[model samples]
Target chain A: MKLEDATPIIQLGEHLLVSMQGDLDDRAVLQLESDITRSVSETQATGVLLELSGLTIIDSFIARVIARLAGMIRLLGAEVVVVGIQPAVAITLLELGIGMQHLRTALNAADGMALLHEIRE
Target chain B: MVLAIESPESVCSIDSEASLVTVRARVRATAVDLGFGIVDQTKLVTAASELARNVLRYAQRGRMIIEELDNGDRRGVRVTFEDSGPGIADVELALRDGYTTGDSLGIGLPGAKRLVDELTIDSRPGQGTTVVITAWDS
Candidate 1:
């Protein structure tokens, strides 16, 4: 499936919300990193909500991509918040030693949006 | 070629990014069939993803084998990843978190180890690498 179809970027007010659903391969995740970065720059968004509740697994490679994507978004002057990480996925990530210490996360999309707005304000 | 298993419960070829997804799905399904809990299933699938990607990144191509194990009252799943790419020069260093020979976080091997109950790696420079991991249902 196409990257855009699997994970679409929606503009919400001054922010971009991407709900990543289904199975995303390595290439798709990499494509998403670039897509989100470019979208942030083009739209001049103030914040980004990356919803990952649809994803069942987040391995090391995907975790690295998320971290890098967050950093890139911040460089573009946009706040990014990851939302809806499944409990099992979170446990696996911690066990894998990927704490994602620098990235901001929320329990769900609504809370993530609030967190992003808080950061912007 | 790596040592061949007489019969693996399932086998998935690792040749591209798509194959990584396939391997994860296959492993997850096998885990479910073997009655692995949600947490255990997620851990096994994630580890399979990391290892499958490693095969593509380093070896260019490889294969994954899933086997169902029965030990008296216990049931488990075993996954083996084999690649004919340039083997790891320092297996010890490779297992260390944040030590990547490539442009990565360098936690695939070690992280995969932590997810499963047991993990072992065999590699020979200029030869190939084989990693085996097992998780038991408790």
Candidate 2:
């Protein structure tokens, strides 16, 4: 799959927002990871918000990848906040025992950005 | 080449990460076509994904079947995954949460079981493994 197939990352000032829409294959996830990591340096963004409200499924692979992505972004000096996880996805993650403790989460994009601002300040 | 079954449903081969993607998409679409809601669709699709990934990671290649199920007034989607790799040595231990033989999160088996209405696993050490999952409309 092309890089375009993955959701685009929107830049709002110093923070970047990536909202996932439908089910993403492993390729798309890897593409997004490389794209976002590159954007972190190219745009010099201080925070990144991953919006997962549109995704209903959070398989073990995807969850593991997201966790690794968060770590990569942090190494690039940007805080990552995952937002808008559905109830089902949340339950699935909990049952899977993948709390993603290293990453922060928000109820929605607005709150996620707010939390980002708090972390930055 | 992608193989097509003569029946109403179809089976896809999972040999690479790319094929796993195809299986996931096909299962999700099949669940939706069977009139499953978003939540149920997600569950089945997720379950399929985990199992398919296992096949690629462990067995090198496998086959997945996606078919519609009808039981009088109830309708559901059923998916079967078969792999001819080193079978599980401990089925009971593998079914329990937090028991992973590989370097994974240990959620593929137990997590999949919770997501669907029915799950059956048959395996013989050094032979192969097969998993069947069924989710009914609520």
Candidate 3:
């Protein structure tokens, strides 16, 4: 289907909190790529917090986009921290060859926000 | 010890996954089950997904065959996706990355070939297209 509605929420503080909502599939991934790239470029926050708690499935195309987004944020001199990755999403990411290495991942949004707070510290 | 399983039986025929956001997640399960390693899973899955999507979009309907070979310690998987639609008019341009017949980044065919061990494409202007992919563990 549409995979998921790509409404990237940006909460500006010392960092940016972007929560993704949708099924992370090939059909809707490219658009997310464009949106994330635009959001990061437009708002040069210290770090970007991506909350995937709303996601149900994490396809490979979406996985690649996640990897690329982390890399892109690094290129822009900002760090990317992921939060609320569902257990299913986590399993899929691992299976798809996505390493949690070099990327910061938290169990829930609260932890992610805390990590962001720590990073700002 | 080469085990040969004919077409249609070898491929993973899943539809909705093509459109799922976490499509890559299924790649490792499919690849490992097909006898590939965790390291090779991503490349194979991505490559296979590209070809599978092509079949769905271009051919409207088709079947994929994923043949895995495991003989005397050698392990690998071969994928053959066949479509009965109008075949490629220009295989050369189609193989070039970013050259898409549809709205993709056009990294489907060429990228798939590059990600694997062996690739053989058989297609004609009106007949159809057959993509044969083989990944070997060395």
Candidate 4:
């Protein structure tokens, strides 16, 4: 399925902002990874911000996919930041040890963008 | 509003990845209807997802039963995943974090335990494995 039909992944300027809402199964997560990686190279985006404010759950499967996607995007030369992780999700992830240490995180999308800028500068 | 007082909701014949996703959605919806907060619902659903995935990855077929748990004033959701796959040779090692038999990350069992109040695993090498997890309302 196309990324647009599944989730809102918008290309703004040189950055790709993805807003993940609702339930995301394994297929959706894989699709996001492929779509984001392609978008990074095609748009030459300097950064990608993933917003999870609306996502109620982030299991190990989803967490691993996010980590993988960040690494993939970085190889394509774009900084990736995840924002709006809920307190419950954070607590669960830490408890589960799916720390996702490789990816950058921020309190919100705007902060994530600012962090990307900071890294570029 | 709690209906499982009569009979627990059951999802049978989970033999593929797609079935695992269906189980997660079913568990999430039941948690919501039982008045579980979003955080608790996410925790239960996430735990269910992890266990369900284990059933698919290892056994290739399994069944799940979701029930409303009540102990006096306490209330919770209990999910039991049963599979006839080759049981773990070392349950302790399997329960340990960062231990995995397959290529995927070893976050299924331990991570699932942390997400719930009670987690129990019953398995034998030649028999099957049954994992039951319960998350109480705080």
Q: Candidate 1's residue-wise lDDT over B1-138, tens digit each?
A: 122223644878999888987898898888898799989999999998988989999999999988888776778888999999999999999999888988788889988988999999999988899999988886
- Index of the highest-TM-score prediction: 1
Standalone chain B TM-score for every prediction = 0.93, 0.93, 0.79, 0.91
Candidate order (TM-score)? 1, 4, 2, 3
* Alpha-carbon runs more than 4 Å astray in model 1: A2-5, B1-9
Report the number of backbone clashes for model 2: 0
Looking at model 2, the pairs that clash are none
lDDT at position A67, candidate 2: 93
Against the native complex, each candidate's DockQ, computed on alpha carbons, is 0.86, 0.53, 0.17, 0.66
Q: Against the hidden reference, what TM-scores do the models get?
A: 0.93, 0.88, 0.58, 0.91
**Worst lDDT 10-window in candidate 3 chain A:** A91-100
| Interface RMSD per candidate (angstroms) | 0.7, 2.0, 6.9, 1.5
Q: Give one digit per residue, the lDDT tens place, for model 3 in B1-138.
A: 588655543445535545322234444455767666544665666666667777777877666665667775777777777878799988888887668778655666776777678878888878889888888775
- The segments of candidate 4 whose C-alpha lies over 4 angstroms from its true place after superposition are A1-5, B1-8
Candidate 3 lDDT at B29 equals: 56
lDDT of 2 by residue, B65-115 (tens): 877777767777778899999999988898998889898978899989988
The candidate that wins on lDDT is 1
Per-residue lDDT tens digits for candidate 4, residues B1-138, read 443453634555678767766787788887887788877877888888899889889998889987777776777777889999998889899999889998679989988998888999999887899999988887
Q: What is the Cα-based lDDT of residue A90 in candidate 1?
A: 93
lDDT of 3 by residue, A45-74 (tens): 778888878865454446667878889877
